[model samples]
Target chain A: MVSAMICLLKMPCAVVCSKIAKRGGAAWISTLAYSLAVYAGAPDVDQIFSARWAAGIDDGRSQLFELGWRPEARWRFNDGGRLTGRLRLRVQTESGTRPGNIENDSFAPATRPQTIGETGELDLRELYYERPLDDWYLTIGKQQVVWGKADGLKVLDVVNPQSFREFILEDFEQSRIPLWTFNAERSIDDWLGGDWTLQLLWIPDQTYHALPKQNATYAFSSPRLAPQPPPGVSALIRSSEKPDRLFADSDAGMRLSGFVSGWDVSINYLYQYDNRPALHQRFISGATPLVEITPRYHRMHVLGGTFSHAIGDWVIRGELGYFSGRYFLSNASQAQDGVASSPELSVVIGLDWSGVEDMFISVQWFESWLSDYRQGFTRPERDNSLSLLTRRYFWNDTLQAELLWIANTHDNDGLLRPSLSYELEDNLEVRAGLDIFYGKRAGLFGQFDNNDRFYISLRYGL
Target chain B: MKIQQLFGMGVLLMLICEAVWSTPLPDADEIARRINARDEGVAVARSLTMRLTDRRGKTRTRETRAFRKYYGKEKRTVIFYLKPANVRNTAFLTWDYPQADKDDDQWLYLPAMRKVRRISASDRGDYFLGTDLTYEDIKLETRVSMNDYRRKTTGEDEVDGHHCYLLESIPVDEDTARELGYGRVEQCVDSEIWMVRRSRFWDIKGKPLKTSYFRDIRKVQGIWTQHRIEVENHKSGHRTLFLFRDVDYEHGVSDDLFTQNALRRGL
Candidate 1:
């Protein structure tokens, strides 16, 4: 046992110390080093640590710079059970001014991003316990559950709320807010001449979208997302109304998946609050009129299904979702609350091809249609989006180049991301990329046109 | 005079019998059957180390633990990445059918995405994870396709001091050749051990593509196993080496381990 412990120390120490020494000084790296010390002290635990730092190029003003360190640990028991804990230590500088008075946006305080030392925050990302019991697998704790088959677009992947702080620039794994959930799954054999599985989820954490506050780096200031008051009118905005109770405001979902004839398919249903808030407005008529806007959360019903089939070198995937009781903000004259309830239908069809050696290409078409359309709504009756992604690996998988383009047909606005990453060593990587946006301000990607910049990041993991 | 004629006819018959007895080698089809019928155990579990070397001589290593089980005529395989922190806990599962016309099913579990994605199995010609060996090369190993290829015994050769028979195989059609990325392949099959000791592959354009050497052939649990393999690509000056260790065939894997759920559960 002593010799084994010595072997373990030598292994991680060589990897961690060498990487740290190469990267030199960084506060997050020091934190990671401290975490490693704790890891080395525990012999029965398995841990993973990584640090990343990204800085944006100059666009006339101070550019965005952020550093983060994440440490995850897993413990296994003799009874075939495992417990995992993960945390993130993040700090940001030159990211413009921070948002104020919106820290408690999520329903659960623990799930909210905890601010520290003005520009730093500590987040408990995930803590879960998983065990296999007879024929069922059970995982209960704060975790992130992903669904659907779409990429870069949400059709049925609404299980967890997301942070729009960077406007979809970050990976979903980092931006998604983990919720306290009870998840279970069971597999059935010889069911209808196919293999099938059923998964169930019960989430008590009613976290809402952590939207960017006003005046922040990636805040919503356009007319489409955030309407401006008329010159003669004044507006008063109130705090968002969120669900407070745990059991009463909980969310639940069920999914049944099956494989038949070389196709994988799943049907799902979720009953939960719409992460996007609906604006409830009241206009007063007087010499000086005032508009009162209140953000409120409403329950929604979502039914969706996804299917994927692989044919030769191509894989085709599709997802469809039907949403009811969802409200949309409108600018109609007769609107009482400045919003209208609309039933929405969303569909995504994607194809991934790997015909070329060392290259992958994927194209997707996403559409959302409102069954009950209203005039003067912020969005169109039928919103269409097309996305193309291509990735190629060179130098024996040590260097990678990728491009992702997403365009909205109605708004004619799109985002183009081109990035190149190289592996410096076994667990260290360096990447540089550009985020470019085009089109009018009323579009989704257009709102970030001025924020287009080049960025570089360094990542080290063990 | 009649007795002399009968004795001469008997001598001719004896000569013919002797010629037939001297030709003891089996045909290509019979040899393929014997190679496929070799007892490779009901289940196998092992750890693999793959080293990929570039033209610049930079080597990258990847470690994985794999399990394989045979269910009648079908085979199921699951591999979990054990090294490289970025890809750790990632798993791949494949269910291979015996019929040549049927396509196999494969699924990949990505830890970062926390999702199981179905991937195409027919892209067998594509390299697996930037390795010199293609997916077909790793999946089928030395097993030759009776439907896709036309095989014939070319001649005799010696590999690693062992007498071997040379078998040359060509894809039956243009489409098969294009799909396999191979115009022709010559295999050196050991006479005593029905396993390929060395193989050379040509590109679909009839250019010399790569050559693979199977080494360290030994018996584990009374079954012939190749513990090491090296492939050198001629077109591109790259090479890949695979080393398998701690092979176990006695402890059979559970049928449940072949399911997609097992991929998500991870190692």
Candidate 2:
């Protein structure tokens, strides 16, 4: 919540100070997108975040919204199947000054007046219609989909990017978008020795679909991702939990993602030449451990492929590719440089262990270098990061022990850091960590003054 | 005799019956009877790691976990997949023996798509990772109710100080193409532990397709567990080896854990 305020206060200020009418539809968009980010995979509880709170060990609106994964029951009398209803309501306050806690629900209005020191809004992340088939299932309306495995910061959750930014900057609170989507999947044949699954996604809205734009700073919208005031400005540190910049010109488009041979791959081609003329040109970013500027982009091509293999307790995984042609980037200004991005390459390699069944741990090293970090094909020498992360799981499915340590550079800077997380329960967790920096992209998270951070979150399935 | 003595005598009856271990060169009748009487039942979770060799035979590995809880009248299972991704999955199934529905309610929660789906009545011969283990293999609705075991051969083996049975037997059922799940299922059981040492399967066309070898057998709560299990897909030329460290059973299972609620709980 504090992070979102920092972002609100730091917003280009132009938008926030603009005549109310000038805000346009962007307001509502960012608003809906704000709080839903917490629940995208609220039920899966795949990583360190959703703990004690989600599994019902604790029941609070924010914790449930962040970690809760509720169920709606169904029974079929005939072959047609049964109808079921599932709904989640999370309550939270905006400015904290808002009385009665009405502003707390996931459905609370984004731009509430006199809300208090709070610069954010309560959100209703997902409310969709679900139609289940024997072998095929569909969820329409507002929903979240994770195309890739590695989540928590959109490194490769290609299917959907729940808004982690709105929580950072109140300006985007109303502009956030949840991809109105339809998903279908079936286990086809096991022809090649591995079970083959065919899945289809129909997105009514692409707000959640990742539409990477270049030249624009990847503002986490929260304190950490957003640029901080030059040291002396304030004594308080600001940061957002998993911040990444995104520009989803959600007119109408769909992305198809799948996997084969240890690699997680996707080919997202959204074109609306007649409507949003600007987005007609494809925009691509190196989608890996979070989007980084990539030299490869084509107004015509957009693609990303990642592969990670765990061989006898050792995992080796990473992604590679290129995009070419006139691509999209920072509101059309940076692209004026003739070439939008560095037209470079990105990759991350990680390894883990499985020798022990009850206990497992993993470490991954990520690298993303732009062949033209200096600019269009100019400087051939490339640069990225060489970071390492570790995650471990404890007994049954209750506790998770995780650590993240990254070494090397982002853009052209050195990053040395560590993140620690302890599983309080299946749905709630408390985390504290820090990043040390020594270069450009080092303003926050890895910025000055130790850059330490602490967070506590809980989830409840409605 | 007092009830206490009767209970103890019943156990003694079972152990003394271990004399059946002596290879009597029993006829098909005696062999079938002896083999079917093995075990206090066990639950298994097998993790299969695949290395897909392309047309050029270059290999790439992907990992997946198959969890199975097998008992008297039924067996329930769930499979979680990782990598070679389109197939990354979570499937729940219950196979009841001597039950009306035959195959229990089955639900698959896919992590990739993030949806739990129900599978209607499916055919048994369906493929299992491109191997002989078919959709029927996962569902134990059909058991060796009636079989004629012809000991084609025997070998001496020891696992954890227990004598093992490595005998070859051909199943009796045929004409089972679309309806039945297994064309043929071969077996090898440990004498003392009663743990299945190895098993093989052939497709309906009578072609050997997949094989599972169990090792590291140990007794847990009066039940035998094979700490290690390996399933090889012959057609795909790939194999998945599962290493089990801590194996516990019937500790405290809340019925709710098996409900649709748990599915959404992402348990």
Candidate 3:
């Protein structure tokens, strides 16, 4: 379907150029050259087909097959300035999994289409234009603005929202949702006597994260009250309202970075609305037993910094962020209760070593702490996690084996992902992997213990 | 009269002994310095194609563009991969200092990550992009330091129909030898051009590791350059052939091309 569309788009342009050439127009050649360059340098299209078959290791009865295909194309304009656009299309079909039961599921209604059955989605990943000035750079349009330099865990990488429909199983690049924004950066090496850069960003659109559907394979199965009451139940229904499309409702941030003494360092600040919604419950009357729940987004201010340095054969990296006025669930018993506000801090430290030939290893530790711990709250005051990644290359680097493990130290829950990938040829690759989860049912990874499965995928680039 | 005759005979014997041992051999340090100074160019740019063949006869070809510039005692080089969709847009940059005591700076840019990462100096011994050449091999031409190695003029030999000087270079210490992954290297340097025509490397265990042959010597912008180079790994039974498609010497290169931003931008 995409090929046909591309042909249709090119036919008219070609005919017009030929006509101009016959009319003896001097500008025809340059015009034709620009068009040809655009065509020749058109971004390569990628098509991936994947199939997953998995069964519960303990029961050996719960089995499922998920088949999917993703096709994406990028078009880069050669109009002198850097301008590019990308279109991605995905289609998936699943067998042997029943439809989700929304009553027991915690996911919002918007995420229902992504969890089961046959579905298709179309997205515009990037549609941006970039220009470099004398000592500054500017970019505008819809794009993904990444921040921080950590792996596995995010400390200050909160510029864009993410999709948890796959429960962190997908690559972060594929999960981060793009936003419409303007970005600029200025070089200050001449003034600062060192290599320094100042960056500013403004996001004008309001976007929310997409969570897993209720009763889905990767969804949380713990008990929870329904977000919306049934019809004719004498209840008040209030949904999370999106911010208005105004400059006052936008988000903004800035970052200053430089390299000093063989170390890369940066400091950043941001003010924005929280991506996740908080629940506020209330009762209208005592005699009628009326219940009301309002979903609202709170404001937050984040201050963060990052640093990386290489020592001997190891590269050490660290990131820290502090969030002020963050909202948390209240421990009050009454239905008419509001979320409490508190300050939170998050930190991550990592090390990468590649001393052995064709082998590389990376380990990271991450933690989060809330200020002024309060008793009886559902959320913990401290959370600690660890992650490890190891990769080995063989057959002249055409084949690679990788193992990834992430464990929550505070909860004793963990996930393991092991994969082997082989490059069949230039622009073509095949990969197979196993995803396993283990721990108590209440833990994060343990909640999806039944979702353990294996998968294989083939990707071909044009 | 008899004492005078004995002193005169001892003086004659001493003079004869001095004359027999006074034919001075070539200084190894001077020879090595001449080899380093032979190819002089302020800047260079070239496009090369590398073909790597394994023991099973499987071949993989890669294309790249490289640029180098000299600023005082510092040399900067940047290389960008141009072919093979998976590896395209990847770049490597290096800044080498003339001072032997200072370590070189190197950075790698990966297009997929959109980030530039610093590479440790200890990892230079690993193979470069699945080729028979290591990072150290590509950097060997610029790292001629007399303090790290001892050079000796062994003999004269003919290489590729040209009479050349046969020289052997060994690490100054055992630790240096182990760190270089090679105990010694033998080179056949052309007498007329002072450029290395062939080189053979031996591992620390005194086993032959690899041999590299340079061919198709030509002058570009008044500098002698080798258009073709071949390296064969004895242990792995793998061979690599580098063919320079285009070469230019003393070309004016912008300093901005050597920065991390240029590496991330690619060619």
**Top lDDT prediction, candidate number:** 1
Give the lDDT ranking, best first.
1, 3, 2
Candidates 2 and 3 compared: the better one by TM-score is 3
What is the fnat value (0 to 1) for candidate 1? 0.61
Ranked by DockQ, the better of candidates 1 and 3 is 1
Please, what are the lDDT tens digits per residue for candidate 3 over residues A1-462?
Answer: 886787678778677656645544122432344364456566544454555455556666535554545443344445445655544445544422422322112222222123222444434455666777676777786777777777768888888877665667767766777777798888778888777888899987676665545445555442121243334456554655556555887889999888787787889998988766666667566656665756666778999999887676688888899988676665545323545667889999999897877778999999999895565344578989999999998777778999999998987988999999987765677888888988877677877787787767766554
Q: Tell me which of candidates 1 and 2 scores higher on lDDT.
A: 1
Number of clashing residue pairs, candidate 2 = 61
Better of 2 and 3 by DockQ: 3
| Candidate 1 lDDT by residue in tens digits, A273-379 | 99888878888789889888788899999999999999988999999999997888788886668888899999999999988777889999999999999897888
Which 10 residues in a row give candidate 3 chain A its minimum summed lDDT?
A103-112
Model 2, C-alpha of A126: deviation from truth (Å): 2.2
TM-score of each model, in listed order: 0.88, 0.44, 0.81
Best by DockQ: 1
TM-score attained by model 2: 0.44
Q: How far is candidate 3 from the true structure (C-alpha RMSD, Å)?
A: 8.5
Q: What is the C-alpha lDDT of each candidate?
A: 0.81, 0.39, 0.71
Per-residue error for A115 in candidate 1, Å, reads 2.3
Q: How does candidate 1 score on lDDT? A: 0.81
